[model samples]
Target: MSSWNSLWKWGSVALLAYVIVRGFSTPLQPGLVESSPSRLAPGKHALTLQAVGQPFAEPDAESADFSLILRSGKELVRTDITAITPHSVEADVIIPEAVPSPAMDAFLFTPEAGTLFLGNAFFVEDAAVGPLPADLRAEAPTEVAPDLGFSFPYQPTIVESIRNLLWHVPMWFAMFFVMGIGFVASLAQLRTGLVKWDLRAEAAVRTGLVFGILGLATGSLWARFTWGAWWVSDPQLNGALVTVLLYSGYRVLRAALGEDERVGRIAAVYNVFAFVMLVILLMVLPRYTESLHPGKDGNPGFNSYDLDNSLRAVFYPAVIGWGALCYWMYTLRLRMNRVEHHLLTR
Candidate 1:
């Protein structure tokens, strides 16, 4: 039985690694490339295009060839062709170099000859380009391209980053979740004076703290790229720190009162208090107070839109994969505790 359990434990680790790698390596969504611009600069600008999709045979890099068109006042001033990678494209257009006496319209054309007209956008100059209208702003374009909805600015790299969402956030979530269970166990120990509950609580907290540290490390790396900060003083971030510290203090309590059975019960009571504080500080406080973190303030967090259909394919699997792995770890720790207790009693 023990050998079977050990094999399963090792298997969980392997499965987690596979999920992480595949989630990151796979492209966001594989299909034809659609042409879209992050923003359009008016007047004497270059309209560039590049390939973006599963690379066609030969050269492996030029995934697709693209066509571009710029029109002003019903006249097509320029038409060009270019190639791009799977994620980004640059197009150049010389918009007459001379300002239109009266403002003109801007437009783009794809190889399929579909027209994308930008309304009165020609007035936006390089020196004073106001924010693009919400319509023109860069987002996952709603209009599915003729080629089965694949479009320009498609980032396969983002799929890899999505793994971080599962590996990182869930670690903290599972940590807090397990620690909360431990906290309950601890309370039971104090109430009933049961050594068994104390042992369970100790093992859960130790395992939970390991996950907590992993969460912090991973979260810090992710934040650096996404938010341009390794750490922020936001409510959510601070709350997480507080929670970790609270558990660490429980360890201190155990050490400080070594050899005292009553001390274990007392420490268990404290752990319960800490868990309640963790919920209030991390969950409740962040919602009520303004936080720089997404999902707390007006800023958005991961959702269907953020994880897109393409990303969800791997992300959901990653969550399940990592959760399973963490559970495997928990079971090992529990078994070890049981063995140690048996020896001591024997």
Candidate 2:
């Protein structure tokens, strides 16, 4: 156990360093973000599609190397690529007078980027709701083996915000770990009425609160960019904040009552109550109520599709790194508490 303890501090430093370097540096996969002149009519109109992700083109790129096709229902509209760049492509497409669907989806097939598709890109105006004309059909490019280098997945709403998974998720996990320690230490303090146990419990709670606050900050940042709001009315999100506030009261309670056996016992009891409230608010309420937070009801989460092996390679290490750091912080706080206790007693 002592050897493991000695190694974990070094482990925390090494793993956390790796997560910081890899998480921020990895590039994102190529994806289509916006289309210029989204509203179109039945005529030869020029269209430009804007892309945001890893560069999808080479310096020596040609129009022939790319294929731009527009879809309205089951029909595909032919388009001629007039120009291509690393970030965008310009195309000329003729929308037939009659089309099955008003909303058109665009598909850009490139040799380097493979394929980039944007749904509801263009809405047709002054066009009859009928089958697309036979003359508008176009063949898509054949699949080619393009070497898209190591990159993160490009989600429509969460393009770059996906990187927050490392900081936001692991910090929450670390908070849970630290709070669990506090809960168990509080139980031990209540049973034995030991000063050392009380010190440990207080340190754990103090360290846990730091992790919780970080979780809230990182989550807020993610919501701001991806959901377009810093704070929103969601069951799980509010539950998380309420739980953190409940834990915050523990520190406030300790500060109000100074050092004493009776006060320590009272604080331990309050600690137990706070931990229970944490579970109920964060775990129980979320299970029954509707939530807009990801991985909850009415919302989708980042699963294997979003968290590919490349992410797992770094994410797992991040969880371990953050958790170990939390433990190390708790130990430092506990030792400081012990020293202060000894000095006061002497």
**lDDT for every model?**
0.60, 0.86
Which stretches of candidate 2 lie above 4 Å from their native place?
A: 1-4, 59-63, 144-146, 298-301, 304-306
Query: Which number leads on TM-score?
Result: 2
| Model 1, C-alpha of 343: deviation from truth (Å) | 4.4
Per-residue lDDT, model 1, residue 95, is 42
The candidate 2 region of ten consecutive residues with least summed lDDT is 297-306
**Candidate 1 residue-wise lDDT, 120-212, digit = tens:** 434434433132223222221233253423222233223234457657866876787678779888888978887878878888888888988
lDDT of 2 by residue, 30-61 (tens): 88999989899888899999888887666354
Count clashing residue pairs per candidate: 19, 0
Candidate 1 Cα lDDT to native:
0.60
lDDT of 1 at 63: 34
lDDT of 1 at 283: 78
lDDT of 2: 0.86
